[model samples]
Target: MTEHDDDRPRQPGRTVARSDPGRAMAFSDAVIAIVITVLVLDLRPPDTEPGGLLAGLLDEWPTYLAYAASYVYLAVIWLNHKAAFTRIREMDIGLQWANLGILATLALVPWPTAVIANTARTGNLADERVAVALYAIIGALLCLSWLVFFSYLARHPDLTHDHVDDDYFAHERPRALIGVLLYLAAGAAGVFIHPLVASVIFLVLPVFYGITSHGYDQGPSFLRRGAGSAKSS
Candidate 1:
């Protein structure tokens, strides 16, 4: 028998299944939940007297800002991850590890958020610099994880749903890489500029990415006419 014939099962037209996507999804869900909880823990109680509630709360504006930014960042990642996995039907060992690494990095976000919030409140340059570096490092690693996941998906096109186009591979990779570069730049800028200013610049990334060449709307199959109509209305 030929190699193809020998590899085939005794039953006709049946292929052996490989990899389990569900497990990966479950793991992702658990990690996301934990990350959200950790973010809430970063919120600190006001230090003012009972009658000075308003002043005490106002003093925590930096903490509120940090929480808001971190929350939005996590939401964006979750949305992107969902979009990516929607097309995926299977996962290899490499993909699993990549996802795990992403979750690991996600868990670190709360610490940096807390540090930045505290430092900004106290107006400490050294602490602010350290917090910025930590946040940037996590962002960079998450970007790396995305690169790994995308590479696996590109290599194993068969794992994706039929509606998914091969061009998605080419489109998302560069966008993710550029985001990493921007985060790194923002982190480095914190050394010279105020950390709060650097963070504001970093926040511009999502807006830029949403409108730029590599945005989801720019994909080949995206319904541009429908989107335009919705916007005009």
Candidate 2:
């Protein structure tokens, strides 16, 4: 639809002075770039003061694992972020604030990454478990923000491209729900099982997330209706 369309849908009890999202998206890109870089800089090299520097490097496997997992997870988030904006056509104050919520939680990712690395390195089973749990907690919050953002778009279709399916946003909610629930489950696994196992869960989750990031015209399998079925109002 053209920008001057008169019959644009809007949020109830809200004004409809939407603006282009170029500035907001550029700002978001900058924020994410800086946050992702922090993990790399946080990768401190193990001291080579021992009889062999090779052994010290080998002992940094935990560090490698934490950095790799966190980095890849952030990459998945970035990919999904780009995909989300492709459907967004306009920006409002609420949408802007919701985007900020994502950035806020994402910026803290490095802290938990460092915690996991250090705790695992010290060979502290209990602390490492707590570390993994903390990481999972942050991941859940991030996913929740994503859920809120998508839900907002679903409820306010005027903020998105006219060509996007009316039910598209509704169907996307399950992907975020899966993340929130799985992240919580990962936290429980960390507390009750091996921290390494929890980390592996964290690492594997991004694959599903990335796959689900793509849009579906009808919806996901579970959310899809039968052939010729009607969409409920």
Candidate 3:
């Protein structure tokens, strides 16, 4: 009688499951959308007299600034999240939890955003410091979540496809470290100095990450490889 493979404790070279990781991405995207929608809903209309619409809008620059900053932050997170998942071929329970951690941090963004807007409008440096500190804390948590997720993926190569090599981790791990350090520094600045400094730091990060991310190359290379295969066939 022929022996079945189920007798083994673990397969010597088990292939990653064929299920696409799109469902996770879709769920993440939906959550992100809802979070952003909630953020916009938090924006209160400026209290003004009749025929003062333009002046009212101009007077509420703080609200606009906070909204723009938070919006950009969310966009950057989504971009990096999409980039990371594109390289993944499979998922595990740990990865799912990491994703949830990130989402939880993101869900907290609206509160700080509202705080900053309210304090900015009031021109109270003391309250502004508190607001900035809160925002920076959230930003730090978000960066830490990303760091954890990347480190987890790097430590577990089996969760990813074959194209990802040691080089990928060597590159990504340091990148995550840099992000964490930068966020910490910004948080400190927010607590010690003017909040504007921290806001500038937060705004600058996406530009840095955009330029330096290894994730940018990962997605297109797969497309190139597939195109080459089609031509060869």
Candidate 4:
């Protein structure tokens, strides 16, 4: 038998099955696009009764900051999602359910984002802590959903591209778990320490995950390879 990820004996009735991911991928893209659009729509121009345009804008820094950070977060998710699908050759019912779970978690991002911005804007420390805590939990759950998704993919090599090994997503699991833990920590910091600290953690997470989204040092592995080729050429 050729060496790959198929060394494991196939389970009865669980033999490899395949289906096109096109429709599902398209749906995912549409949903993610809508979420991003909604995030921006949540922003509003600051009231300008006494303050001028610049001051009004400045006063709404929390809103701008929230939008900026959330945009980057979604961008990272999109990038990683694109990478994951690129390595997936087919889809199964299990994969479809996992994907839906992930998307469901993602769809909820705008709520906490809006809460954080609105609370911070109001200068209400209690509300800010609550908002940050909510954000942290949501972020953690999203990370956990990714863990489930990856774990499912790891076990279901029949759904993966030929180039991917069984251990590929297994290795990725740790990174996802790290995200989960850090998010919980951020939430704790918000509740016990200070919301500003949690905000910093929120800003930092996307950078970490984005860089190692493919379980590598520099972003998605395939994209890095493509970039390396273009540079060498």
Candidate 5:
């Protein structure tokens, strides 16, 4: 459909607005870039004598671990966001707010990621677990924001491109639901079990997230794919 066409299939009680999502996508990209940059800033140098710098770095393995895991997780989140927008055709009030919600929680990520790293490095099991619990709570919020964004689109399926299946957004619900549940379970483990275990759970979250991609492949789309390719080139 042409950019100006109000091509989204109409449904009872649904209002369709012809919107260009490019601006919204660009704004989201900027916000996500800032968040990723802040995450890198959280990596602190090992404070030690010149000769002992190697040992100091070794002692701060937890910091490195947390940084790596968080970095990868954020990467996955970005990829997922891009994948979703590929099918999204317009920016409505609800979708705009939903996107903001995801960004809000995502912006909080660097703080908790750093906290987890610093606390884990102290080698205090109790404090580490508390830190893990805090991190898990942040993760839950992030996942919840994603769930909200997806649900909003599901309820208003017309926001997606005509080439996309109406049920596409609805299919995403289960993964988002599972993500919330897993985050809660990890939080429980942090509070009751060991923080190290909870850290592992956080590290593996991207893999669990991959489950959502199983059916997202639509063999590329005439509307979104060509534009995406041009932008990339």
Candidate 6:
């Protein structure tokens, strides 16, 4: 007996198959959870007599500030990651690995947070400089990761929805690039200025980017068309 070949409709062209979005999302969620947990480890128990509540609380202010800043920064990154992934239909192995690397760097945030908080409490310039440098380095890496992930999406337009066009890519690249530059500058400033001041300047980059995103999104039409053809297929 001879077996007949199955007849079925074939997808057009050489399309690359992608992995389950659930797996990627789960991995990201786990990484983020670990990061948040580690952040809490940076908090130190107040050192004072049981009844000296006010003094103990005052002594722990640096820790509180570090915790607050790190928490907010991580939350923002997580939100941005969620936004980027929500538009993704599928993920390639490379993209998954890139995301994992990003998460790994993010998970390391508690170290810098603790260092910075301790340095601030002790008023140690050397320790403060080291902590600030690490913080800025982490920021730069985060920006680079976003750029890498966005570039990957830009390369594989099919993985994203129709509305993600050249304009989004064009606007986003500059934003990420500027963030990288800003973080590097902040790291350099840590050599001279107080770490807290350098960190404040670094934090402003996110605010600036947020304010400019809408305007950049509405920029000249030329960027919209330049790479628009790539997604047409």
- Provide backbone clash counts, one per model: 0, 0, 0, 0, 0, 0
Worst 10 residues of 3 by lDDT: 1-10
TM-scores, in order shown?
0.80, 0.89, 0.81, 0.87, 0.87, 0.79
lDDT of 4 by residue, 109-212 (tens): 99999998888878999999999999999999999999999999988776776677666777677778988999999999999999989999999999987887
lDDT of 3 by residue, 134-226 (tens): 887887788788878887777766667655653454346555667777877886797798788988997888776665444533435664364
Model 3 TM-score (2 dp): 0.81
- In model 4, the worst 10-residue window by lDDT is 1-10
The top-ranked prediction according to lDDT is: 4
- Summarize candidate 5's per-residue lDDT along 1-233 as a digit string, tens digits: 46543644566765556477888889998999898888888678888987998898888888888888888878778888888998888778889989999999989988888898888777788888888888888898898998999899988887888777776776676567777888889989988987767888898897656544433333335524543454356
Compared with the true structure, all predictions reach lDDT values of 0.71, 0.82, 0.75, 0.85, 0.79, 0.71
Clash pairs, model 5 backbone: none
Candidate 1 local lDDT, residue 147? 74
Clashing pairs in 6: none
Task: Give the least accurate 10-residue stretch of model 2, judged by summed lDDT.
Answer: 222-231
lDDT of 6 by residue, 160-231 (tens): 555555345544666677778888889889877777777787567656544444324443465445434433
Candidate 2 similarity to native, TM-score:
0.89
**Candidate 2 per-residue C-alpha lDDT over 49-103 given as tens digits, one digit per residue, 9 for 90 to 100:** 8677789989999899889988888888888888888888888988999899999
RMSD of each: 7.2, 3.1, 7.5, 6.1, 6.9, 6.7
Query: Considering TM-score, where higher is better, how would the candidates rank from best to worst?
Result: 2, 5, 4, 3, 1, 6
The regions of model 2 sitting more than 4 angstroms off are 1-13, 216-233
Q: Which sections of candidate 4 miss by over 4 Å?
A: 1-12, 15-17, 217-233
Superposed model 3: Cα runs more than 4 Å off: 1-20, 213-233
- Cα shift from native, residue 168, model 6 (Å): 2.6
